[model samples]
Target: MERKGESRGKTPRAPVTERDSSRSPKRASGLSREVVVSATAVKTANPLAEEFDLSASKSHGQEPLPVSFSSPPLLDGLRESVLQALGQSASPTPIQALSLKHLFSDIPEWRQYLLASETGSGKSIAYLLPMFHHLKKSELALPEPTSSTISSRSQRAVNPRALVLAPTHELSRQLSSFAKALLHNIKLRVLCASRANVKSTPRATFTASKMAAQFTDDADGTLGMPHLGVSRPVDVLVGTPNKLLEMARGRRWDRVKDETDKQLAAELSGSRSETSSKSPEPEMGLQNVEWVIVDEADILFDPDFQESTRTLLADVAAARGQPVPYTPDLLRSSPETSTTSTLTQNTPINYPFNLILTTATIPPSLATYLDVHHPTLTRLASPKLHRLPSTMKTEYEGWTGGNKDADIERRIRKVWAEDSIRSDFNGKRSKILIFCNKGTKVQSLGAFLEGKGIPNVALTKDSGARNFGNNHHLDGFLRTTNYKPKPKSSSLSEDKEPHVMITTSMLSRGLDFSPDVRHVFIADEPRNMVDFLHRAGRSARAGQAGKVVVFGKLKGRGSAKATEMKKKVGALRK
Candidate 1:
């Protein structure tokens, strides 16, 4: 039988290698674990207990966050599955609906140009369904082996053959867990690509349409270190762009053994031991890679991130199986393809690649540029940029005139009321995502929330609690340090989903948190239409209704866009 989640990305090492500026590892075990309890529990608190109510969480562990629904929905199985996997239930977002038809079939050719919907349209599911089906089918075809010993050292690894490149550690972690949950009872190899963790015994793999395994060193022992027995072909590898790029670069560690002279010196110093004379083996590195998934393409594929993304694309493609050396017509976009492009502006015979790029919005100019490099791209089209509902209310408070901070404070207090929010969470709390334009404003708002004695926290790029590795062109830090939030007496719990997370656009795209997110507070003015829509998409996710709260001053309030949105929805109804 084909394994449900066959390995996605695993390949042999290439001859050429490169290095990254911020090569570091990040551990996401801290905040991620608590999210389950906080998001699932119904604000279940043990009154006098400083921490959350563990018993309450267990009792309602299966309960989902409350998302508004105006009508009797038709999706029963889908809703149950979502709530079981993600702790929330709502109809498929517009993107999910649009992608449903595509997902029901095996259209391996239509993988590229998959920019269907915006931030909260559940695009994660759009691509994942096809990937799961393909992996499962691939697994079923292979014969059951008795042992994991590599018959061929060069072709040791089995299965793993896909790559998912998200923008942040949090998002990558979220995707891995999500896929793992869905592909349960199947053979799959999912790996993360942060330079932080060291792959002690890096296994080599040979496969097609997969990703290379990249491991990180973990001293805390929270994340289970995945063991590869078969020198096995890996199937899926997911990580941020920089970490994957570093793994693909395959840096060689120059290990020099301690000489016997040093042992003699240590003996003279009276601290030598007989066991200190063991021989050391040569250092090793990552191997072949295959499939590639730019999970959140919008953030990582922007102009700023082109260099690293391009470099990663070239390296991963160069190491993939078959299709041999560079050719004239080989370079093109083929959804999930990792080939490099062959041409550039004013340059006809540019480089070629099988790079698959997807996002909610793809401008004509950008499409043209990509066409120059990917002449054979199959640009998929959708009626709208995103499939999220427009019925969600959108409010804008501007500050073009005076001190808008006061106004913002007054409103946040009104909508996200401390007492009512707690009661709402107690009755049924929903995950809340808050967005802001600048880091300073995020800090200011957080401080205000604290000053008001509200139990809340803020997550920004520059939090003193964060030690990021590199900027890596991602909206988030390429890698993070041990610095995380000081464990709050009030942290997100499974039973009580993340009721509120003050953030930037960093949380906009990577992970999937839909209709369940009932409230969104945008504390700053959107710079452009793209920014506005991206921020707006956070409120009403999946098919659940939601409320959007924008913080600004009235003098500069611009509802022109909002008016247009209402008009469009109205036209659709008519």
Candidate 2:
């Protein structure tokens, strides 16, 4: 039989490695003896560096994850249910198998939870499995409905009890679709922040394609609102942070009435004063929200977002004591608002919900902060099939000079010799994703790679019309523009599954790259704990094996500084 590590195909590559510096530090060569030594020392059965490329990852604080791991409660059953729903052909990959459990287990006293796993580890499924269970298994209730007594779509909500937040639009769209598929038989009304414009607004833009729409519709008109939707609440709900914030801040969400969204649209078209002046300010409606999930959690931990989240939580806590967080249009949308103006006159929201967060890689700093703020929060880690094993090759070439761009390119070319390329030129198709620290560096590298005949795509920050190309900050890109949208495209889903996706640190964690992405070339070094988490998590996921190669300054002034940072993180973890 062909060796497990044998090459599967061919992929064009840009020049690799960084520029030559004075001290091209001695890296842990992933050769025979080294592989043996590391394996002997390895604490767990995860793939070793001999098979995975992890020269720069030796210093990470992670404990290798085992193949068989257990989850908390209710989480395991939830995962099993989703797995069954997907069918046998759509089997759970190894990483998914490992991660699904821990992500779901409950922390009874804690108000928060966090997951740290790399891409291709079935991170999405981790949260989805449990959230679905929370909705279906939990006995919840929505607020009430208005307008036509015949009932509306959202009014069917057992009480539209939960809210989920995502960072990017593309991610939001991807997740909404995933939720729909998983809950095909259940009732789940998803209101995305990027919803269809009432007139033409990004905030109003909803992303329910035909099939997705089926899932968004509820048995009652309250499917999308607090009262009807909340009263008859659906099993689940998803939205973006900012958009949800705007909705919560605005008034109007009393109950689901006939033509509810339509009425709100007209009201939104008017001045804010006119909208809020007619109704009470919209606040948190968490009574029915038994489970609240935050996706792309690393991004949410940003100072700006964290502050906003605190405010959001405060709102959810107050919905019971305050009036319905509804707008005038919501009142007009629901004829009942005229009669039931207060919580005393209508259904009151009073209940606690579980909070769950998921991310491919989490920053230790942020994790520390969260722990400090929410003392009882719990953290879980997922396993990786792509480990830094010694059997895999590990080599480094350095460059030094005042002409930064030229030196870096030269170093990259030196490392991209014909030997490092895929063995089969025509049969093997490889995609590479380059990680860069600065936008300027990303631009330079992308331009150079394309110039050198490599079919590559660059994801960068938008510089006010200065530079652009499939760039997505936190609000995710549109799935239509991306090359890889569907997870199960048979064209390239098997062993040779790597696609080159160049990005900043944004694409680091919580992503899944099935069997194809065997080689991980890191142009940037993981400077801190969270950064390290993302880099190390990339290689092996879903039980399929893989490798990762990191190239950057690991010596001299810059490298020394990076070293110090690593040591500090190490001490903290201890």
Candidate 3:
């Protein structure tokens, strides 16, 4: 079957280009570099590589990894649910297809993998499908419990079977939405715990009882027996690392309850007393997690999130009766010289649960980190992992110093006017994404564009974008607009002008824009190849053609910076 984004019939394999240091100029130290492959190389040329246009390798270089194109027969209900969730996409993308092969295989080592593929390649579905299938299978395997056993288990704390972690609240919510769609026909429940959700709801009203009611199971045990007394069990838990860490650590509810009761009594009697002490309760729910998927591995592993992420992973290991594989000190030490007390070269360590890390690009540092820390991690990479989409056209404009903002405004007007006359315009206003290096620039540029009579919206980390929630400006900008202007309604008509969104790098990764976004304007040069790829990837998604225009200064120190960025872009395109 043909994939959703590709053309009809078979696509011929493009030649792979390995990175040769002799053929290119030397790059500065500490900058991560990846081998360049053609974006059109969606078919494998090597016989050993097999189907799905994927290359399977090991971090430790132990042996040739096996490949499979066939997917095991899924349960009838699950198969239908998966197909329904996929919607018009009848077949899996290359990455999803390859991931299914290993996910259902008998090999235990294949359980742990690093899924590296380009943007818009259906990475979320690649992992979610297998996760749902496995969780369902495990549920069906369990025998019916007795009435007494049900009562006892219901009193116990919640222990989720699957956990998905994302770097941001918006990404976590998106992942949760996809998972919920997949489980629509099935009885399984998916829960999302994020700061956004918490902040939007009242603390008193956001109790476990209220959240549990939303996911309560019906009679006949279709949704599986509830682990919590009043709430349905969570099959999959998706959230940000900080929030999940807080949930996993739990709270001292007994002490809080005692303190509240004492305070009420004292209020009635006009007396004061010391608070009571109570032992802490068990964790909210991570003890029984079977599968842990870390989305956006690069961001999650960085210094900003490294500590919390490591602590959470260690907690999971401890709960699963396995040794903690990663620690701050261990991560700092050289992998060649570092040794674990629980692990030896001669011993084969058995992990209790499957761990999957997914990313769009595999930088040198990330590659090395995984190799040393997770030596047995199976690598599943698409042929276009580090390459830009073949259909994207990039334009570089030089800015020679003064009046940079004016220059950008003129360019925006030109692009907007050009888009207004396209044959496929369909009378609806097109959208453009303008990316800045900092949030302050985003605010200033957004205000400048508004003053220039352009309809625009700005989204920064603190701007509360939250995927268009509560941000009416962003909502109107992103919404479909094709209304006819009424007579004497020139102001209303101006609101329907071509929409432009100004934002910082916070919106660069994992956010999917509408097809109307055909142009990406980089107001500032990207810091690195990874940043450039993600920002450019905002357009030309799902095999659609798009354009990226980069504006850079061409004088003084800016000139040198622009020249260097130009070479990097050229290397990416090559």
Best by TM-score: 3
Give the candidate order by descending TM-score: 3, 1, 2
Q: For every model shown, what is its TM-score relative to the native structure?
A: 0.59, 0.55, 0.75
lDDT of each: 0.44, 0.43, 0.61
Pairs of residues at least 3 apart in sequence or in different chains that clash in candidate 3: none
lDDT of 1: 0.44
Which structure is stronger by TM-score: 2 or 3?
3
Q: In candidate 3, where is summed lDDT lowest over 10 consecutive residues?
A: 20-29
In angstroms, give how far residue 123 of model 2 lies from its true place. Answer: 3.7
Q: Across residues 1-574, which tens digit of lDDT does each residue of candidate 3 receive?
A: 1112222213312222232222111111232222323234443223212111123221211212212222354556666766655443356565665566556654444257777778767688778777888888878889886888555444334558888998876566556655665675667888676433333211232344434444433221122223444665678877777767766664443246777789778878988756544324333556578898998887787655667776787788787777655555543434445575635321332356888888887654455465445555666665567667787899987775577778788887787678678777755556789999999999998888888888678878877555333222344333112222235355667455647889987777776566668889998877676788889987877677788999987666648877777666665555
Local accuracy of candidate 2 as per-residue lDDT tens digits, 298-341: 66755545655545655665653433232222112122223645
Residue 278, model 3, lDDT: 39
Clashes of each: 91, 95, 0
Per-prediction CA RMSD (Å): 16.9, 15.0, 8.5
Taking the tens digit of each residue's C-alpha lDDT, what string does model 1 give over 72-94?
23133333334444444333333
Runs of candidate 1 exceeding 4 Å displacement: 1-111, 143-160, 194-233, 251-290, 321-356, 386-388, 398-403, 417-432, 464-500, 514-516, 556-574
